[model samples]
Structures are given as C-alpha cells and as structure tokens.
Target chain A: MTDASLNTASTQTGEAGFGDYFALLKPRVMTLVVFTALVGLLAAPVSVHPVVGFAAILFIAVGGGASGALNMWWDADIDAVMKRTARRPIPSGKVTGDEAFAIGMTLSAFAVVFLALATNWVAAGLLAFTIFFYVVIYSMWLKRWTPQNIVIGGAAGAFPPMIGWAAATGTVSIESVLMFALIFMWTPPHFWALALFMRSDYDEAGVPMLTVTHGRRATRVHILVYTILLAALAIGTGFTAVGGPIYLAVAVVLNVMFLIGAVRIWRRDEVMSEADNYAVEKKVFRLSLYYLFAHFGAIALEAGLAPFGFGGW
Target chain B: MSFRQEHELHKRRFGRNLGLGVILAGLVALVFGLTVVKVSNDDFSVETQASGGQN
Candidate 1:
C-alpha cells in the first residue's frame, strides 16, 4: 500500500457513516423486493388503506434489508475474497460483523411487529419466514454446500409478492402463487448467466456456484433449460387472474428474446466466450434484469388499468 | 481553538445523527397517520353505530 492509501485507510477504518450502514442493507436487492411486493399488493382483489399499504411495503423492505445485513455478516469471509463483494461494509472494515448482526436482528424484529400491526399476522408471519429462510436456510446452510443454492434460495426472494397479497387480502391465492412462481423460475438462469461472466469471483470465493462445480458447459445448458421452463411459466401466467392482454404481449416479446439469448449462451464454448469477453453472457445478464422488471411492471400496469375496465380479459 | 479543528469524523457523526433523526421523525408521522386512518375506518366505528339505537 502507498503511504497516502495507508493513512486514509487508517483514518477511515471503523468510522462508518450512514451510507455505510445503509450499504449493509444491499439496497439493490431491496429494490427488487419492494417492487415485487408492491405489485403483489396492488394486484390483490381487496383494496388496502393507502397508509397501511405504504407501511406494509416499507416494513417488508426493512425485513428484506435486515436479511441482507445478516447475509453480509455471515458471508464476510467469502465476500472479502470476491472482487464483486470485497468492498462491502463488513469486508472493507467500515462496519464490523457484530454490528451488522445487531442491526439485522433489531430491524428484523421491528419489521415483523410493525408489519403485523399495519396489515395482519399472516403477512407478518410470511415476512418473518422469508428472513429466516434467506439468512439461515440459504445463507448459512445451502450457499456453501450446494451448486443448487440459487435454485432453492431464490424462493426467499420470491416470497415478497405473496406476503404483499396476504397483507392486502389477508390470504394467499392462485394469483400470488403464480407471481411467486414467475420469479422463482427466473432466478436460476439470471444468476447462472452472471456466474458465466464473473467466472473467477465465485471460484476464488469457493462458493459452489453451478459454473464452478458442474463446469461452464453444464452451467450453460442449465441456463438454457431453466430459461425454457421460465418462458413457459411466464407465458402461462398471462392467462392467470393477475395477467391480462398487456401482460401477455409483454411476456411474449420478452420470453422470445430471453429464449434466443439462452440458445446463444448454450451454443457458445468458453473459448468463444473468452475471445469476445463473454459478450453473450454479459448481454443475457443485462437482459435478465430488464426481463424481470418488465414482467412485473406489466403486471402492475394490468392491475392499475383494471378499475378503468381495460386491464384484464 | 474553540472550533477544535472540525475533523471528518465529526462530520460523519453529524450525518449519522441527522439520518437517525429523520428516520425517527418519519416513523412518528407514519404511526400517527396509521392511527388516524384506523380510528376513522368504518370497521372501528361499526360497534359504536350498532349500540346507538340500543342506548
């Protein structure tokens, strides 16, 4: 380290600002949580009081954030080794792991209690289970042990909409389940595509990602298979109660694009990928983000237009 | 001397305090709003309305 760098590090070590603490929440992940949950709430048959709806989404987001903090705390060791996560609060020494744990526990409890008060016990119960599944079942147990980690752990991310539906209607239904299925199936291909390009980070971090354990060829095939399955699910959802003409059109266009991308990924070898810096993988990863957002956005749009008699069939 | 040379540490501390203050204020407003909405809800007043003829 340079003298200037060392001096800066020394001065800033353990001197966390509010942003550092916020970073512990993994705000990017929370965005997906908040959006899905909002879509679920809006699409429900029952109308929620506006304040209660807002509070439900907020507490759900806080619960998601709390789980992220706990994941960072537990994964700090591997995070330090991975280039993608090396600059996280705990790994970078901006925040200690213990502090992260405390914040996570505190926020988790606060979110659950407040969500129950704002909506109902069913929503609160699902929120509490989501945090436990993400932190304990996924982060602590499955992540390091199996290449199937993302496949199962993805369920944790998929629960927000279900919880939101429960919050608004005080019950779970076929519509919410279909929404959950959409996200659940989309995650594997989305993450595996990322693993294709970020090849060394997971390897170095010793995580049993599909790319690291089953090899790149298998990972590619897995992506293709999952994308095909995901396409079927996404398109089929368009026929569900939560779906409509707008959602069907959006799903058709996006799924075709996603399938073509998956086929390209499956056809390319590592040599071809490396020759062009994994262009197809990178493109697919970018498309995955848009794919999910567009799908959910379409669902929300369908719900929004329903009152005007233009949303659903 | 009175200023004590105002370091980066103090600025960060101030920011943390300010952020906490805003979050607490937001929580208070949210709770108050929820109370008003819940109290004024038709469900909450249903019991009062049902007893009015009997009393």
Candidate 2:
C-alpha cells in the first residue's frame, strides 16, 4: 500500500473524534437520567442551592453515562449482532472495547467521588450502586441469562430520581420512591412495545427478550399487564405528597390513553400487527414516551407551584 | 520551502484533546463553586475559641 492509502485507512479506523466518545456515554439515555434526576431534586421538600443541584444532576448523569459505557463494552458482542445496536461506538468500531471499559471505570470513580464531595454520601452511594447494577448485574449477568432481563434490570434506570432526592435531603422518602416506582413500572411496557416491533434484532442477538422466549402473544399479554399496573401506580401517585391537582389531571388523562393503547396491543395478533407494520405498537411506544415526560412534567409543575400556594392539595 | 500536510488523524486527535481539556476545566470550576457554596453556608461554620466561649 502506498503511504497515502495507508494514511487514509488509518484516518478511517485508528482515531475516533469527540462525538464518538460522547456516543459511548449513550447521550439519549442520559437525557432521561438528567430529566428524572432534576425532577427528583425539584420535588424534594428540602431546598437545595441551585449550584449544588446542578452539580448533583451533572454527577448523576456522568455516573449514568459511565454505566452506559460499561454496558456497551460488555455487550459489544451482542450489540454487533443486533441491528438496533450495531452502530454503537464499540460495535461500529468507532471506539475500542478496552477504551470503553477504561472510560467507564474512570468516569464511574470520578462521578461517585465528586458526587460525595458535592452533595452527600447517600446520593454518591446510590450512584455507585446504580453503575454496579447496570454494568455487573444487568449487563453481565441478567441480560444473557433471562427473558425477564428488562424487568429486573429496569431498577438501575429508576434510581436517579431517588438519588436526586437523597442529594437534597440526605435520606430516602416515599415521594422519591414513588417517582422511582413510576419509572420502574413504566420501563417494562415501554421496552416490550419496542421489542414487539424489533423482535428480529433481539432474536438475532440471542438476547432472550420476552418476545423471543415466550412468543409474541405472551409478550403482548405482558405488555398489557404491566401497563395496567403502571396506570394504577401513575394515577395513585396523584394523591401523594408529590402529586397535586395538575398532576392528577395529567395522570388521569395519560393513564386512560395508555390503558387504551395497552388493550389494543393485547388484542392484536401477529398477523394484524404485521399488516399495519406494527403501527399501533409504534404509536403506543410514542405515547409511552409522552406518558412519562408528561407525568414528570406535572410533578415538576406541582413543585414549581408549591411556594406560590397553587401546587399541592 | 519544506511543507508537510497534517493528517486527518491529527485533527481528530486534536479535537479529542481539546474536548478533554474543556471538560477538565469545567470540573475545576464546578469544584471551586461547590467549595464556595459550602463555606458560605451556616452549617459549615467552624467554631472558634471566642465563638465557643460566647456560646
């Protein structure tokens, strides 16, 4: 090979840009982490300094991103096999697995230590556990072993809001747990809907998704069951300290719509799904996103209005 | 005149280096701000001998 060609090849493969490293952090998931954690901080009864709150959220997001990097490193093999994750930094060859591992470890330590110094040890400890849970428990152990992987692994994603509340109050509370529960229960149905449409990806990767392990019919039933439970939790949260009139209204409307969507999903067979390209499933998935965002938004609204005498019941 | 073209790899490396530099600088600023906030808060006050005597 000519020097020019060698140089071209090296440029294409040898070094990754800033964006590639950022991609290793799974920025999309970080958005959810940041948002939920912010809501947790805001919804807390105790007031935190703006700077401290910002730093807490930043560290939580970094901790979350660190776990994402580790998850990508551990799952690089399956990620390559699955079309949905084939383009991830590790799988696409933009970043090396060792690099991902190193980054994950370094950032995990940095985030936890900095969080302890900035906020309280409780929040920092929770962040540490979240990273360990997502990487070691969820990614390494459960993901390949069980069809209920997403169900159990969802806990890692649910901890940020609780961590945020702890950052403010230095203790856990029912309100924070309710926020955590909202996400925890919502994760199964949200992911299952996506799995229904993208069944082949998990099957190809041998990930043992509910759809692949128990058939699509069973997966549909699981979706409906989880959604019903989630709806109950979402609406019930309306009466909690975190909930207010506005929150109740949002929860009622969204949960009703979510229930209708879930029922529709449960009733449809594979033939009906394929005929419409899983349109209903996709729509429900989209609504799930709105359902979560609106619920959290309502909580934030309640918190925002609290001092003004219009927020809580 | 002696001239050499910078490889594309060099540019990417430069960008990565710059990004890390910015992030490190931001961390320094954040730590500084946190220290200031902690020190200014009443809970963080150190009790001097005179203050302890007064109490």
- C-alpha local distance difference test of each model: 0.94, 0.92
Compared with the true structure, what per-residue lDDT tens digits does model 2 show for residues B1-55? 4486788988999999999999999989999999999888867565454488797
Question: In angstroms, how far off is A105's CA in candidate 2?
Answer: 0.5
In candidate 1, position B3 carries an lDDT of 54
Identify the runs in model 2 with alpha carbons over 4 angstroms from their true place: A1-13, B46-55
* Model 2 chain A: worst 10 consecutive residues (lDDT sum): A3-12
Provide TM-scores for the models.
Answer: 0.96, 0.95
Model 1 residue pairs with clashes: none
Candidate 2, A25: how far from true, in Å? 0.5
Cα deviation of A56, candidate 2, in Å: 0.3
Worst 10 residues of 1 chain B by lDDT: B1-10
lDDT of 1 by residue, A43-131 (tens): 99999999999999999999999999999999987887777887888877899889999999999999999999999999999999999
